[model samples]
Target: MFDLNCNLRRGISRHYAIDKITDNHPIVKSSKKRIDKEYSKFAGILIDVFYDYLLVKNWEIYSDTIFADFTTEIYQSFQKYSGDIPPAARQIIGCMVDGDWLISYQHLDGVENALDRIDYRIRAKMGARIKLVDAMLILQRESIDLERDFHAFFPELQQHILNFSLG
Candidate 1:
């Protein structure tokens, strides 16, 4: 139990570190800036989702494994580690696997659906009215630039993780 708790803490710390690195990276910041002012406040969240779509769309360039196989493996890992996962994350994992959310990142409608869900959550939790559903237009308009930024940034992020692991 001690080891399990330590490992969970480490994993959560690493997740936050990666998020900070991604959020502060210059290329990522530029990608956020490319989004219209209407979504300036939510640009980070939108870019994160958009980047997932980009990653899935360009998966062949980054990984030898089939995307479906990769996502399946991830879902299996979630199940395998279900006992160790925090309750909140476990709930999300259930929804993600049931909806095939990772695989859905490859499609425009899937991306729109994700944004809509986020919008709904924000409205429900914060009473903030946001039209993240309309972010699809911005995504379409800025895809070329966003993809270019992603290509430049992802390799750096991979290296950062490698270094983080080694350290």
Candidate 2:
């Protein structure tokens, strides 16, 4: 149990490390910059969600397993390890699974819904209003460049994770 806890902590640390790497990567920065100036402050957040959508959109290029099957396995894994996850994350996992969020990422409506939810949260927490829903228009307009950036960046991220795991 102690070893399991330590491993979980290590995994969480690796997750954050990977996020830092992604945030700092030049290609990701380029993708973020492609967003409209109105959304410059939320560029990082938008890029993160946009990349998830792209990953789902291009799932066949990256994974052999069907996307639905893959998402099912992920949800199951979350349930299996629910006891190890923090309470807040568990709640999020519940909502994610219930909403089929990962599967929904493949659709434009799902992406819009995600942006709307983020917009609401930002408004509530920061008392700052931004038209995040309109971000979909920018995403659609910049789809080609953003997709190209994702293709270039994702392989490098995968390699980095592999190296991190090996080290």
Candidate 3:
């Protein structure tokens, strides 16, 4: 999944020529290792974060029925794959599965709150000073473009995860 996200970023970068990372190079391999390490440390939090963004924003594209019900079903699939997620994310997933955080990323405040929670956990565990506000600003700035890319990317990702879970 992390590799998929990285590849998606690389694909998106081709259009903008904004990313510094190059694909299939030694540097890219090293970067992916670092990325994988962070991902494992976070224990699959990015999967929920990215999927939540897609589920909320692209809800209409994926469903013609009630949003809540559709979200429930999708999240249930996520729950089946939640064993690898860290304890912190497991708790968040419980809330999300129960609809407590239903589409929170739909609003700026929700984004901030989510970033805060992530920053808190990462800081607690690693004592790293990840300036979440800085991260939030980048997301806010490129939201439109990012959403466009996400719309193009998320469906395939959803299917991939579902297939992986079933396998």
Candidate 4:
């Protein structure tokens, strides 16, 4: 299993540069809150939405270059934080990198396959079934809204990562 804590530590070490990351660091505290609010509880939906956003948005930052190259680099960087991710997620990561899945995830069939894989992994690793039908229904019904949300969310995330990297 990928270790979330370990990956977070690696991220902090790479970015925050605190002598030590304790429960007291603002980033650490904010991370906890953000994880609890956004990821810990709503990971699947957020992930799909984020994935869609990455694909559909214009992202002028990459106006002169191929976005696939950027995603390819990001995938390679995942090894730095590989400690915390689950084996299933690790498999998905491999598929994403090997398949250039960020671009593939933009297509309808790719989205379906991604959701199916997520559900399958959840069932296999957690012994819990996540009914993807409802999620799929939402995707079909609120795709526009979801795209708007992605447009709003992903750029900010990109900026944050960039700022963190530059810090």
> lDDT tens string, model 1, 10-76?
7778888789999899999999999899899999999999999999999998889999999998898
TM-scores for candidates 1 onward, in order: 0.91, 0.92, 0.53, 0.56
The worst-scoring run of ten residues by lDDT in candidate 2 lies at: 1-10
| Cα RMSD (angstroms) for every candidate in the order listed | 2.0, 1.7, 11.0, 8.4
* lDDT tens per residue, model 3, 72-121: 76587556556655798788778766655665766667666776777887
Over 4 Å off, model 3: 1-51, 71-99, 159-167
Model 4 per-residue lDDT tens digits across residues 21-53: 222434323323332232344444434444454
Alpha carbon lDDT of residue 133, candidate 1? Answer: 84
| Residues 108-144, model 2: lDDT tens digits | 8999989887888899899876878888999999999
Q: List residue ranges in candidate 2 displaced over 4 A.
A: 1-3
Candidates in order have lDDT scores of 0.90, 0.89, 0.54, 0.56
Order the candidates by TM-score, highest first. 2, 1, 4, 3
Answer with 1 or 3, whichever has the higher TM-score: 1
lDDT of 4: 0.56
Off by over 4 Å in 4: 1-50, 53-63, 71-93
List the candidate 1 regions with Cα displacement exceeding 4 Å: 1-7
